[model samples]
Target chain A: MTRDELLTALFPAGCSIQPGGFGTLRGMAELPGTGRVEIIGIEAGTPLGIEGALILSGHVLDLVAAASRAPLLVLVDTAAQEMARREELLGLNEALAHLAKSLALAAETGMFTLGLLYGRAAAGAFIATALSTQMLVALPDAYPSVMDLPSIARVTKLKLETLEALAQTTPIFAPGLEPLFATGAIAEIWPPEALAARLAATLAAPPPRADTRDALGQARGGRKRAHDIAAQVMAQAAAHG
Target chain B: MNAPGMNAQSDYYYEASARERAQGLLDPGSFTEFMGPQSRCLSPHLAQFNLTGAFDDGIIIGAGLLQGMPVYVAAQEGRFMGGAFGELHGAKLVGLLRAAAAHKITAVLLALDTGGVRLQEANAGEMAISEVLRAIVAARRAGVAVIALVGGRAGAFGGGGIIAASCSRIIVSGHGRISVSGPEVIETNKGVEEFDSKDRGLVWRVTGGRSRALLGGADAYVADRISAFRDAALAQIPNAPPFTLESLQAEQARLSQRLAAYGTCRDATEIWRQAGLEPPAPVADLSEADYAGLSRLPEADHDAR
Candidate 1:
């Protein structure tokens, strides 16, 4: 979908957003039932880097300093952080950390935060921005992964055909909204037409940021070991104490 | 092995296993590992790919005492998959951090030596790390000091790097390196001329403890010895400030300044000079003590901010 289409679906009543000076979208808009919120949106095909992370961080910092407790709406659509010589030399990790910490601060302060993955939410960019939210909702077509399939194949030293065959049975190695949803990384995958209404409901009553995804993943059959491992850890701690 | 109460005399922080590091950092006989190798909480994803899974995945989590103060610790095993986080490993960390906050632990020490998310379980690893971030924030909100110690050979990179930065305080040994993207990835994408991943010296200058300390990414620099790390953690954990709006605001400003000052620079030395440390000491060559003596960013006054 085009950027305008996605924005309209997210904010049906309309919102004003301008270029965030780094190919990102940032602005303020009112939700249907919830009060106004600051919006930071990354375009679908663009790459995020130091500039983009700084823009997002600046917005979060401003919101925290403000008297209003306006929630932050993060719309993610980047494949990954920009992989360039300049970005690496300049410490892109620190830049991304700033963004993550800003979002974490916002969440800690009781400001509702929501992440809507409209397109690609991949790699460091996903961790820096989208993963910081209290709740994450994705469109049916959203693509989320640690790394793309080709990169994964290279790192694993496996044939693409073999990996693809494995992906058919396991959500762990797959890259799509389905596998993410199965793992409970995404709270829900809503249809594009219903995104605005679903978002309003989620904002009104956001889920607590508890570590329940592992259990959810187990129930969905995407991950069977996470819940058991956590259980063992907790049990051992209790037994020792 | 030495007696349970006797601290090993050698510097084992770099070569020791995750459990050994945890045991060495904590007070003698005070460490108690949960979900250890006996629990067999290995990664199921690895088995599917015909890869062997370590019994504890790649992390060791438990409660311990640091200088007599109650603390929870999580140390990643660098030898096992480069300390990557998969579904089980990430959940283990999340559960431990949650318990730390709930139990009102005095501090939470994370001995990180990772290259970030596991590639075999890409989606699961990413999600697990995300949950781990949330848990760390919660623990900090509860007034628990979350300290990250990056000293192992693997250092911390990718998602692990971001998690390290989210902690209340970061202490790195001279050999530790931290970055979001590994140098090899950068070299592959941007060419060797832009960033020679094979040049260990250049890599260290870009992401090592010294550079990270000078750039305001890390809070302290210590020697490569385990005792040095333990001492640093003891000094900071009890006095570390809780997460507050003012402190976060200050952090925001500091990061903004960093981006503004070094965004265009192609060399790590230039960043040191921009920070007003002209005639900068060679970061990789300087002793940890000398590196810590250099001029650095002013400590954030959470209350004053």
Candidate 2:
């Protein structure tokens, strides 16, 4: 189905809708006349540069706080942030962190957060949205990794020729589902054909653990020590308190 | 000039390489490395996309001593992807910090020299960095002194800047610059015509060591010289052998005041000047003895009221 058709089915019958930045449909979706609001929207990366991600994140936060939603639906179609000298300098990482904080704060304050990574889920901007949520569903086409090749060569100082040879065998350093899966950094990787079904299933399931991402790491053997460490930290804090 | 019998102090000393800096920042030799060069944790994503590089994922994390003080140190190697943190790199950092906190290490020093999260590994890198932040916060709760040392050429830009900002104490070299967004980003987002990224003075004025120090972001500003950094680290040891929430809260409050003062100034030099500190031009030119003399000036009344 087309993007709009997918969004139309997700919205409540009477909730008003409007176009947000990047041509994504945004509006409140809730049961009729309840006045309770659930901000729902879809965003694309091709427009707004990568910096647009921050703007999109900010708008979503404002909508949620203004509407006081219990669960928020985020539909992502980012190919990743634009690679520009300016984006790096403006401290996109902090902007990215700010978005993460918003979602976390919302989660702590009793909001259900879900993300559908419809496209490229590359870089911090991409991860910030999905990782901060209770569940993340990604389309098969998504190409996720820390960065591209030339940038890596420029910084790591390795001869590009050498990087090519080594990448062939090492999934740990490669992008896509392999590395994330190995690290248990991602909880679930869904196919494009079955995304809708998966999303419905996840939404139907009880809100998973506070951070299923950490548990996913252990269950999948991607990240070796995240859960244990988090537990240790909490234990220490509790003992002190 | 290199005569064998020369007793010159310069002859006996040599500058530390990035690797050596990473090694020496910790204990004499207690560093047990994971995913180091031998482990070959180079980025698979970068290579898949046709980038080339070497070493253990562009970061160095291990345990060592800082003046008999047991500690864990993470030195970001900017030479590698601007010292960006990718999946493995971030994992290593988070893992080590986790290890340190779990074991209750005396301190954690981050010799940050990054442009932030590596782009090739962007997705994982970003998550890893956030995880590390949460980890540092957790570490601090266990009385672990977290020191962010920013002196290397990368100067802790990008996401690394935020991580540095959240540290218990930030130790910076005069040449270092720490900012949430780098000047280039400002120029890009705002416009190059409005701001110049090439202006060294402008960059320093905005985020340099003296600026950070005056702004109260850096707990102390030491000379760019490595020995000065070592000395400053030693000085902090006596006062804070173990990190505690109360101690960190006090430091955080102090940092808040430092940040607030920036609202009233345009440049670090001006902030320092207002703080009664000798400006950087003169301070940078001062001999070790002269600089020490200036540093010993009666403590200014800038402490939070």
Candidate 3:
């Protein structure tokens, strides 16, 4: 069934769902008497940063600051942040920082930040959502990676034919839900049939005290122990210096 | 000191020499290049796989001045591996940012033009970008501004897009395309009918300046000229500060409204109209700066939220 169909079935009594408008960052939710928000798909490159995407992302944060209320549900669908020449000119780092700050602020406000990766989530987008959430649920089909296949080819300059072959056996070069699973970025995968119920249950739950980005990192064997590894590096640097 | 055959400056402003452009973009004589061609920090993985690598590890990292404010800049050299972010490439960038933040520098400018997460050194590249993001977060928390400049045919794609999105502010030239997957990947996955990679107009609408501007993804859209970028960057750097929760929540509300208005729109013009701009022709024709000036969300609008 289509995602719309599933939502329709779950919200049979004429529920109100809103779409994110252009130049507008926040999505509102009027749940009966309560004013709940559903932040769907804070993806990258939704902006046209002729110079860079990050500058616009910072502006997006301004829009986020405009929104009121907490306990939002962020449905994540970004593959990564924008990395165009325009984005660089506009300051990619600063743009993404805005979104990160927004998410961090949301997480700080007792906002029940639930991440639902309905599609792809990689790199900065993954960090943006995961860093702010208590836990993240990935749809089975969603593919997450730091970068995608062809990009790997372009960056690595490997023959397309060779990279395609390597993608099958190597999780490092390949992008998908399975690789993300191997990375421990995902806490659970919700079957399409169970998506609506799971989301509803998540929305009903309380906000988590701590973010799971570092935890997920350790869980996936990517960094070993978040700051533990970073601590090691810092200690070594300090000793050497 | 012009080279024997080379003009003091190149003809195509957008495609000018990366080094020359980087030098010219900042305050005169302010740039102190790190690594540089002299460093010979080319990708080790490149020659092992028989691929060529550029000197300075395919990225130019150093310090410069933007209007006398101390700024650290990193520019990707697209000529090398399409400016892929390799281990050394990412490390140089991360190191520069870490130092800049540690020193309490005022700003960081990243001139991005690459397909992110270099596959030859994919693991290190990915880790590096993640670290950079964390670094930027730290910098922002401590009151530093980061600005990304997107100008070049290579534009930004893949992981590069996320890096752009993470910045505190962004400036884009008309030529850039910021997206997770360039048209090729979208076409491969969604079919040619959904997105023809060759369709310049379609590609622009998906990730181009006008589309992103309407989407509120870019803070300012500059002309293809480099000076335009300098002006926009200068304007944004001063406004950088850690935002309060109310401000962030407001921005979130605005994004939600924006997606609602044009999430299904077929044309960039349509999105522009919904964003309170005069329809297609007018918005499309405005110069990058003029459009940005007119398009900023009004104070009243912010208050209403």
Candidate 4:
């Protein structure tokens, strides 16, 4: 979906989103029942680089400095990070990390930090934006991938055809909303019809700050023992560390 | 000069296994691992793919003492899948950090050595990194100092680089390279003229530890020895800043200024030259002394983090 279509549907109550750094969107929106929320987002398919990330991070920092702890919604729709020498040379990792850190700081301020993945995302750019949020909900048609199957095939020495065939049924390495949901990377899939209401409802009562994707993944059976392992380690450290 | 400490120790961090690094970094016999090799924390996904899995899943997680100050330590074995983060591998680190916060442990030492997520288990691996990031920040918010120690064969690219960058303090050795995408990935995405992965020296200059340190991407540049890392870790433990709005603001400014100052530069050398730290010799040709002596350069005000 286009950014405009997604934003309109999600904030039909009205929003004032302005074009932001390099390839970003930032502004404010008011839901029907919920108070104003700061919207930080990326333009569709724009591979996020240093400039865009810094600007997004700056927005997050601004939200943290607000007098009242306001909710922040991230509209993530982008490809992976720019694969260029200049981006890497300028420390894209640090830039993306800073963006993630800023979102983390916002979460620390007792704000309801949530991401609405109405478009698509992958790799470093995804982690810096959609994946960094306190909770993530996605549109049913949203696309999410860590690495493309062709690239994954090249790296893993598996045939692209084989990878493609497996991706259809395998949630572990597949790229799509359903597979991602199965892995619990996406907390919920917002129905297409009631995005604005969904936004308001989610804002009214957000999930607990404690991350539970692993537990969700475990329960869904897409992942195994990740939650148990973390719990065990927590238990051990409580007794020993 | 090359050895920095001149200890002439064969305890090269790049050569050590995750368990060995964890053992060598902590006080003798202090580490009590959680779900260690004996526990066989293998990767179910790798097994599903008919690939053999490492018993420890490429990461070592547990707690030990750093300078008699109780801390949680986790290290990655670069030999296993180039230290790529599989589901269990990422979970182990997350577990360690979460445990640190729960126990109110003073700090968590992270030895990063990976090219980020494993493609075989991409969904789980990617989600693992996100969870790890959440865990790290959560631990820091709870007053646990998370210090990343990087000096391994893999050099912490991709999500590994992002994780390292998020740490309260990062100590990188000449052997360590940190970046979002590795050279080959770039070469694949953008042509070889942009970045030839075979050019090892070019890789070092672009994403190597010295370059990362000079650019303020890393806090400290240490020698490649495990002892050097341990010493750096010991030094940073007490001084590690708690994750607060003020600290992040400072970091934000530091990064912004960095972009503004060197954004136009096409090469890492340009950044170094712009920072006014032109070495008398090229970094590669310089003796160990010339290379490891970056701290002697003018300290940037933003280096406090």
Best by DockQ: 4
Could you give candidate 3's per-residue lDDT for residues B47-82 as a string of tens digits? 545778777777877777777777777788776677
DockQ, 0 to 1 scale, candidate 2? 0.11
Task: Give the clashing pairs for model 1.
Answer: none
Question: Which whole-number lDDT from 0 to 100 does residue A39 have in model 3?
Answer: 51
Quality of model 3 by C-alpha lDDT: 0.58
- List the candidate 3 regions with Cα displacement exceeding 4 Å: A1-127, A130-241, B1-13, B241-243, B279-305
Top candidate when judged by lDDT against the true structure: 4
TM value for model 1: 0.94
lDDT of 4 by residue, B139-166 (tens): 8888899999999999889999999988
Per-model TM against the reference: 0.94, 0.61, 0.63, 0.96
lDDT, candidate 4, A186-227, per-residue tens: 888988888888888888985567889999998887777788
Model with the higher DockQ, candidate 1 or 3: 1
Q: DockQ score of candidate 4?
A: 0.83
The per-prediction tally of clashing pairs is 0, 37, 109, 2
Local accuracy of candidate 2 as per-residue lDDT tens digits, B1-305? 11111121221102334556655554445555544577565555566556686666777766666666667667777776778777667767777777676778777778888887765555456667767765665576566777788887788865687677546567787767787556775565567664468977667667766545544456677766555665666665444422322332333334334434433454445555665765445544556456445542122212210
The weakest ten consecutive residues by lDDT in model 4 chain A span A61-70
